[model samples]
Target chain A: MVEPLVELKGVSKSFGSKKILDNVDLKIYPGDALGVIGPSGTGKSTILRIIAGLLKPDAGEVYIQGQKRQGTIEEGEPSLGVGMVFQQSALFDSLTVDENIGFALYRYSKLPPKKIRELVERKLEIVGLPGTGDLYPAELSGGMRKKVSLARAIITDPNNPDNAPCMILYDEPTAGLDPIASTRIENLIHDLLFKQGLCRAYAIVTHQASTIRLTTERIIFIYQGKIQWDGKREEAYVSTHPLLKQFFSGSIEGPIP
Target chain B: MNRILSSSGLWSWIQRSWAAILLSGKAIFFLITRKLDFSSSLEQMMAVGPASLLIALVTASVIGMIFTIQVAREFLQLGAGSAVGGILAIALARELCPVMMAVVVAGRVGSAFAAEIGTMKVTEQIDALYMLNTDPIEYLVIPRLVACCIMVPALSILALFTGLTGGLIVAQMYGIADTVYLDSIYNFLDVWDILSGPIKGVVFGALIAIIGCSWGLTTRGGAKGVGQSTTAAVVTSLLAIFVSDLFLSWLMFQGLGQGATMIGQ
Candidate 1:
């Protein structure tokens, strides 16, 4: 059997007396696209962060492939090959497009600036944002910033094949875009998956059906931090999971409150 | 009901407060523990150095000009004009340099620190740093603290030098008597005079870093929180500088004596 690229086993997290995640488990196989959907603040983004090693779980284990977690970030844990594009796009405003895109490379890679620039430009083109190198983040539109961030995430992935997580986690990749822009982004997400011959194990946490339908091969319904339903995207409508029914209908009387 | 509320309720609140303090302490302690080798800190210092030089130069020059113009006017009107150079040296070297530079830099660099860190905190980029086995404080705060501690004083020294030169230009251009000018100047400042200013610079740097980083780390209200923290860092740092300046001045000279006094003669 092929090894799963990323897996979460019985993971749980809590703040004070409130439990956010309980006995949650998930897996993404190499070259598989996973979409996580649920109500706002349902810990969908939290899961993405956990996978990225951003948040520590209170119980259970998170394994990147099969490695047992051993240390905090202070330990300089090797970059788990997982790159994340944040919900806010979190691009550095002080940095220009070239600098922002080249940030991680400059820090971690010994590549010359010219090489990094070339790589950055190519990554931007892959994300449908060509020739936007000198612009500061504030000058660009929100959608453009998100694309730059995506380019930043993907640029080094092709180079660091051995060390980094092949699975990328996108936190609400299309959250604030207009319908047209969202569709554009949705298409970009698909194109990126196939373009680089990257592993298919990306987990995109989003609320838009258009994005989910376009980008994911499988959909995992997360509600109140536990996995409520897991199946192929085509099985979404037929599945009688009450949470999905309530969430898909976009109703007021649901388990979400 | 009253009995239950009296003990456990108060006790719980105390425990919560203690926990919060401990958590913040852990953040600081952990950052301190994970510090890179001195050579790495040295490298960061080297990088942050020349990048910040130009701003310090421009600000110090302007401050010098203003300080000289006003000081020359006061001494001139009082028939002590020739003494303008000495007064300028004493005031600019001892107080104005550190104070003005602190306020200027606190406005420029301090706000930038708060905004950058605050965004990282909100977006979980900081947490991302943690996951990658990077201590956010070690990766972020140490370099900032080291850089600012080095730069703030560096800027202050420049300001004092320029302000005193500015006074010299005023005295010479205005035709103050060279005899009184030199006498008053020599009478006022000595090696110890200049010594006090750089000391203030060190304190100012610490104040700016502590307030800016603390506010940035605690930011929670999203964009508004980042903005508010930026504003708070500048206001609190500048105010703290003024208050501390007074206390430092008192302890250095006036508190030890009635006022400024004779040095070893």
Candidate 2:
């Protein structure tokens, strides 16, 4: 059997008797664009963090490209080949947009300054924020910052192929964004998967029904840290699962909450 | 039972402080073992060093003048006025310059470090660093550490010179001859006395930087937490400096029977 790019096997996490996640198993194969949809504060983003190796699980294991993730990020082994774009855009406020995009490359890649700048420019162009590399994160609009953040996450280091992320996790990429900006981000996600095809897989944790329905081939519904429903796009809209129905229909009369 | 109960708070403080110290030790170890971002360290030094010079100099100068004013009159009345510069030099070199300069830095640079890093922690910038495969110690703490260690000692030296200049001005006001004061300094002060101040500066600098960075890194909550960390960092750094000064003074100057007395003479 071909191994998945990333896998979570029976993973569980807790904080002081509060079970944030429990017995969660997930897999992302090559070419998979998975959307994780659920209510806010129900460990949706926590799943992304776990997959990105920002947090440890209390039980089971996380695997990156089939290797069992073995050390903490501080230990210098931060789940190789996984990149995450945080909900808040998390750009280095001290750095310029290009500098933030080129940060990991400038640190780890053997690429020279000129080449890194070129790559950064290309990423900026790809994100539809061209020629804005000199601007700082504080100077950019919220959507612009998010786009720059996405550009930062997926900018491939050509000099060092190993530094390239095979998969990316996006946490609430459209949160607090207007419909136009959200659609732009959604289109960018689709283009990133189908056009550029640099990364093999991605997991998006978002509440936007449009983002989930358009950006993902598969959707997993998480409620209270467990996978409440998992299905294809067509199946998701038609599923008789009460929670999924409630979530999709935006109905208050359901098992949720 | 009472003792255990009474000391629990102290024990908890020790545990927390020790963790911060251990993380600082790890930062140092990483600095020694890994490739560091020297550009960031350079920027930090530029921000921390020359920016702090005026205040450090002013404080040291005022302290030197005050010490001279208090000592010169008493010594002159006792017919021991020639010893004023020597006493000032000994006191400033042994304790005053380093301790006071550290206090200034802990209040200024140290508090700034805690607030900045604490803000970063609360806002998930630290987490972003981790996500980007960057160690916070290597990226943040070590740069600040290197800057503090270099700048504090450099500032202490400047403060020492400024202090001596202050003493000279005060001596002139008291109608004491420059020759007599300079001669006293030459006769009573040694290389060890001057060197001790810089050594203390290095230790105090490390303590301030480590405490500030650790407190910031460990900060929870939000803006309120950052505020608390800033205050705690400065307070803890001052406490560490004072307590460590007592031990460091004893270690650096203890059992030096002739040298200690001769410096004062």
Candidate 3:
């Protein structure tokens, strides 16, 4: 059996009095397009943050490429790079799109300015935002900022292949976009996976149905701080799990509370 | 209820103060290791130094003129007109210039640091920096610290000179000769007295930078959090300046009877 790129064994996390993730065991293998769906205020995004090494679990362990992570990313990074696209696009308002995209490279890599600019331009083109490099985050629309952040997430230094993210964790990539914009982002996610092959796997936390159906192959339904159901995308639609049924139906009454 | 609220508030202040101290320690470690970002430091220096020069100079000058005006009349009435410039110089160097410059910067640049970083924190841009493998301390806090440490002293020194010049002009206006004013300053102001302003400035600058950055990094909620952090940072910085000034003054000028002896002479 192929080894999973990332695994969480009995992981748990809490904020203040509220437990966000409760003994959550999860795994993501190469080539996986996973969707994490849940009611609002559940720990859907928390899972992604844990996987990305941005947040530490209150209990249990996280394994990246089968090696147990000893501490948060600040202490030591995983063997594989994990890129995250934040829900709000989180671009540095002070930086231009090119500066934002080329931030990691400019800070970490020995690549010259011209080479970095070329790479940033290429990533911009890949994300369908060519010639928008000079614009700041404030100048870009919400969708455009999301695309810029995507470009930033995928822009890697050719000189440092180890720094390239093997897994991408997206937090509500289509949360506030219009339908057309959401579709565009969903299609771009597919193109990145299938065409560009920028990352080996990705997990998206989203509430949009179109995003779940169009971009994910595997699905997990989280409620009450635990994964209530895990199955293939087709199984998610027909599963008899009451939590999934209630969630998909958008009912006021459910086991979620 | 009031006791509980006040205790919680005190605890929060202690927590913030501790965080700022840790941040300052880390910044000092980074500085000693020579892991400085020169570009960002230069940018911050421009913001903290030259951009604030006009206001600092203006405030210092007015303060000097007012002091001379107040002292010249009293001293001349007592046949001690020659001592007016000396007293003004001592006050400007040992207290006014450093404290006033710090207060101005704590209000202006310190507040900006908190608001900007607080916004970044709430917007997740600080997290984005972490995701990009950039330590926010190294990227954001260190440069600001370095700028304040270097520029605040420089600004205080300039303000001291401006205040002295203003005092000299006012002394001349009060019928005191320029030579007498200059002689009085030379007699009263020693090397340590001249250096005190910059020394106090360095301490106040570190306080302002560390407090502002700490408030920002700990900011929660959203826009409201940013505003609160900004306000708290400035208030904390000002309080720190005044309290530290008291200790510094005592340490630097304790048991000094030179002024009394000079007056007897």
Candidate 4:
């Protein structure tokens, strides 16, 4: 049996008096493309953050490549590199595109600036934003900024394969984008996963129907701090799960509320 | 009133204060270990030092002129015209220059640090920094702390000289010859008095940077949060400076041992 790349067992998180996740067990295997879909404020993003080791669960264990995570990312390095693409792109406004993409390399890698720049340019080319190394985040369009952030997520140290991301978690990667822009991002995500083999596993948290249909092979529907339904992508549309039906049909007449 | 005291606002402030203290401790540790980004520190120095020089000098000059105006007439009427320069120098070195420069920087640079970092916090750039395997304290707070620590003192020294020059010019205008003013300063001002300004500046700079950066890192909400953090950071820095100044003043000049004896001469 293939081991799961990442697993969250009985993970729970809360904010103040509001509980976001409750004893949620989730697992992602190598080559898995999972979509986590739910209504707003349902803790999809929180799950991604927990998986990336950016946020610790109030209760439970997170196993990264079979190693029980000890603490938050600040405490120690994870067994595998987990890259996260934020909903807001989160690029440093003061740095150029190249600098934003090559931030980790410039800070931690033994490579020279010239080599880092070359790698940054190569990542930019992969993200289809070539020759944009000199431009700031403010100068780019919203979609371009998203692409730039994608490029940043995929950048890795050439000499240190251990540091390369084995799993990528994208939080709302296609939200706030026009359909055409969403299609481009979806295509790029597919290319990175299937053609480029950038990561062994990935998860996307998005509300976009097209993105869920196009980019994900498996789907999990969350509601009221628990997983309502879990199944393959194709079965999501036809499932009789009341919350899933209401969520897919855009109906207010169900258990979702 | 109990409800007000128990409000989340108060709790949040406590949390932020604790976070700031932790950040300051971490930054000092990194500084001791020499684990810092030199380029970032240099960039922050430019912002904290040369960029703020003009305002600091202007403030010091105006203060000097004002103090001289207030004291020269009184001193001259008492047949002690030569004491004006020494008094001005002592006042500037002991209290005025360091406090005034700190206030100026707290308003200018401290507020800016809070707003910039608060925005980054709201936008998740701080989390992104963590994702990229960068410690935000080492990358962000230490540089600002280093800049403020180094430059605030440098600015205080410069401001002290500028204030003296301003007092000298004003004294000359008041018919107390430049020679008289120079002689008085030479006789009355001790080396410790001159060194105290920069010493206080180093302490105040640390307060400003640490408070500002801590408020920023603990910022919640969005634009309104950033605005509040910026305001709170400046206000907190100002309060910290004044409170620390009281203790620093006491520690450095508790008793009038030397200055009083020099006056007896």
Best by lDDT: 4
Using TM-score, rank the candidates from best to worst.
4, 3, 2, 1
**TM-score for each of the candidates:** 0.78, 0.94, 0.97, 0.98
The Cα error of candidate 2 at residue B222, in Å, is: 1.7
Error of 4 at A170 (Å): 0.5
The digit string of per-residue lDDT tens for model 3 on A127-189 reads 899998899999998899999999888888898787788888899999899999999899998
Clashing pairs in 2: none
lDDT of 1 by residue, B194-250 (tens): 888888888887677666776677677789888977887787778778999999998
Which is superior by lDDT, 1 or 2? 2
DockQ, per-model, please?
0.32, 0.66, 0.65, 0.71
Question: How many residue pairs clash in all the candidates, one count each?
Answer: 9, 0, 0, 0
Q: Candidate 4 at A125: error in angstroms? A: 1.0
> Alpha carbon lDDT of residue B39, candidate 3?
95
Candidate 1 lDDT tens digits, A1-257? 98877888999988788777888988788878889988876688878867777677888887887776554344456547777888788776657898788776766677888898998888788878889998998899888988887887776634666754487788898999998888888888787776665445689999888998899989989877789899998888667777887877788786767
Q: Ranking under lDDT, best-scoring first?
A: 4, 3, 2, 1
Q: Write the per-residue lDDT of candidate 2 for residues B1-265, one digit (tens) a residue.
A: 6578457645545655887979878987898899878899999998788999899999999999999999899988877888888888889888999999999999999999999999888878888899878888889999999998999888888888899899999999998899988888887788998899999999999999999999898888989999988998898999999999999999998764343354334
| Cα displacement (Å) at residue A163, model 3 | 1.2
Error in Å for residue B200 of model 4: 0.6
Candidate 4 residue lDDT tens string, B27-146: 888889866788999999999999999999999999999999988998888777888898898999889999999999999999999999999999999989889888788889999999
Which segments of candidate 3 are over 4 A away from where they belong?
A: A76-79, B1-8
Task: Extract clashing residue pairs from model 3.
Answer: none
Per-residue C-alpha lDDT of model 3 across residues B1-265, encoded as one tens digit per residue: 7678577777677778898988888888878875688999999999999999999999999999999999999989988887888888899999999999999999999999999999999988988888898888889999999899988889899988899899999998999999888888889889999899999999999999999998999888989889989999999999999999999999988884475445423
